[model samples]
Target: MNDLLQHYEIAKKNANKYMRKGQLNAYVDALIEMNHYKKLMKAVIAN
Candidate 1:
């Protein structure tokens, strides 16, 4: 729970950082990771 939220925030920040740096690939990857955490969070809550 907390860990997932933390990782989600980290991934979001990393996505923003990569976007600002013009690293398209990295930003996309970070976004995917963020979404992954988001889904996991939702699943946890649902359970």
Candidate 2:
């Protein structure tokens, strides 16, 4: 969880850079997908 959060923070910081260059949408989408995976991990851990 901590590692995932760290990655999220890092990705967020660079997200804007990508957005300005018009290459960030795909990266942003990837981040969202990663978040979903993290949620799934949390759910699995909870069980």
What's the CA error at residue 45 for candidate 2, in Å? 0.4
Q: Evaluated with lDDT, which candidate comes out highest?
A: 1
Q: Model 1, 1-47: lDDT tens per residue?
A: 99999999999999999999999999999999999999999999999
lDDT (tens digit, per residue) of candidate 2 on 1-47: 67667665666656656677788676677568567757866876798
How does each model score on TM-score? Answer: 0.98, 0.53
The TM-score obtained by model 1 is: 0.98
Best by TM-score: 1
Question: Could you tell me which residue pairs clash in candidate 1?
Answer: none
- Off-target runs (Cα >4 Å) in candidate 1 are none
Candidate 1: deviation at residue 35, Å? 0.5
The C-alpha stretches of model 2 lying farther than 4 A from their native spots are 1-22
Candidate lDDT scores, in order, read: 0.99, 0.69
lDDT of candidate 1 vs native?
0.99
